[model samples]
Target: MASPNMQIARNARTRVADRVTSKVTDALKSDTAFESGSLALSARIAGAAAEAVLELPAEARRTLTRRQAELVRGVRRLVETFGDERGRRKIELIVPETVERSVGEGLGPIVPEEEGKHLLNELAVARKIEDWAGTVAGASELNRDYGIPRSTLHRWQHANEVIGLLKGTKKHVFPVEQFIDGRPALGISAVIGLAGSHRTAWLWLRQANPVLGGRRPIDLLKQDRIEEVIETAQAYFDPQ
Candidate 1:
């Protein structure tokens, strides 16, 4: 039999768990996109799923075991988050560099064949995005070429004032075009916010937009044509 003190502790833990559950539910319920059936909705659901799975109960374990398909979809939703138009990046690289031999070589022993294949494909897509980010340079190169301090650069990356692409295991590569006059261009942050994620924003900035009269947004940013670039980005990402 459990002692009175032990029972009290258990009740306290249960109450805490209940409160956490309520918060997660309320957050999603109050969201405007809860019923939108958009990626926004999917993202919120994935986050809520993660929080629910964190609960200390047999139901949480059962969720992992019984609702495996939902969990897989949640994984995809989480992956898609790396490209949020709000300019969030330096996301962890969970997949290997190459998909070749990734399956039967090692993963087959663990992940199911179908699941392994899907994981590798996602990895390849991520690598392609990294390539689109252009030839990246480390902090030393950026500082030497741009004359900026490592501390300041790190702060900019943290604040999304500068685009920082996570390339390898734990290193980040910055796009050279993002800088002008030894600082990030005036509209880089805005473009990122309007465009969504670092990968998409960088890709769009590098491409010549017809709306910008065939001028790349990055070039316009360098030239301080911020209004044109922001307008273009807004239309491109949130076209009515």
Candidate 2:
């Protein structure tokens, strides 16, 4: 066998040759140049560029590799979190449902003014739902952690005001920190009642409250200060 240095030199030559050939072929196909004799000049320029790329700084290569790894991790998290029933439901919510309607029923091509309004409304709704879902734990994860049936949790979504509605999936998702020791945290339902939606309630619960000495309302609720937290939530929605 040839020595390692010889093998490396051979491989480098092969790569340079490939780049040059490809560039020349592309130039001819485009027919941008009048003379086919310019192929050699184009090939040489392409080969030089390829060699410069191969000689890029080690730090540049490391940065590129790190960025690629981070991108892969981000995509994986998105798939795991939103690629389930919830994601599908969210898609449905954003996409307007087609209902068979007569021209008299205000069902036809959307006018310019109405189209913009409709799009904005859908975007606002999608953002609210996505924000809530991001803060909550999905049914599958909660069920696995607490041995609660998915079906039962879903029923609670309708029965309890503390459950937030998600657009994409039919699954019921609750705030990840809403439960402690497999039991609902105190004051969640009361706050939900005052705030009208779980998203609004969650925002209030998470924010610092003056009455609680600048501590998050959720922290106070976890400490069994249900009445105080509920009062804070009320004040949050309606201040005297």
Candidate 3:
């Protein structure tokens, strides 16, 4: 019961949606992490495009150039969301600054083709050093190496007062730097709690601080500059 012109316009919109879906899918399929859920997201995008075109006036929807532009904008939005989640996790390892940059740019993918490859290579190297900088130990290792009892460890974890990251099967892995001379370092619990979780604390602890004369917090802690480290952590927790 629709007129021929209306049916033709509807068919054109369907073709635009299909084209956009194909382009978006092709762009994302290269990333293994993206491929899993992308098909479903792409379908949703196509449906959204169809609905959006309907909301436009009939003449606007019939304009091929306008329709193409709309499809491209929808596809870009899809890519941005995918990029943001992937960037948040991987960029933390390669370059922490990239996370802020990505978000500031509206969660868009910030890396160009050549730059992205370079980042991927750096990420591969970073993974190798993860044992020292990013690794965490299980409860048994903590007990053996640092004499931390499972009950006390779990207590801190439950209280959200330690640097244990949950791993496979709900097992918690504590960062090695949390220990010193068979005990948890003084003020570490408070610092961990204050900095708002282990990941943020890890970033603060590992990076050089201008206030500490460019020395790393972990190095100061290793030197038993406990009070200074705590002050630095507090500064980092609530900076000027």
Give candidate 3 regions above 4 Å deviation: 1-135, 159-161
Q: Against the unseen true structure, what C-alpha lDDT does each candidate score?
A: 0.73, 0.66, 0.69
Best by TM-score: 1
Question: Lowest-lDDT window of 10 residues in candidate 1?
Answer: 100-109
Model 3 lDDT tens row, 1-240: 999999998788767766777776777777677755767586667656766766677788657343453345456776687666543544344546544434354666677899989878887743333554566788998888778899988887776556676565566677776666755556666677778777677677878887667888777776777666776666567766
Tens-digit lDDT track of model 2 for 147-179: 767777766666663456554666546776667
Q: TM-score for all predictions?
A: 0.48, 0.44, 0.42
- Pairs that collide in candidate 3 are none
Candidate 2 residue spans exceeding 4 A from truth: 1-113, 118-135, 167-171
Error of 1 at 109 (Å): 22
User: In terms of TM-score, how similar is model 3 to the real structure?
Assistant: 0.42
Where is the poorest 10-residue window by lDDT in model 2? 64-73
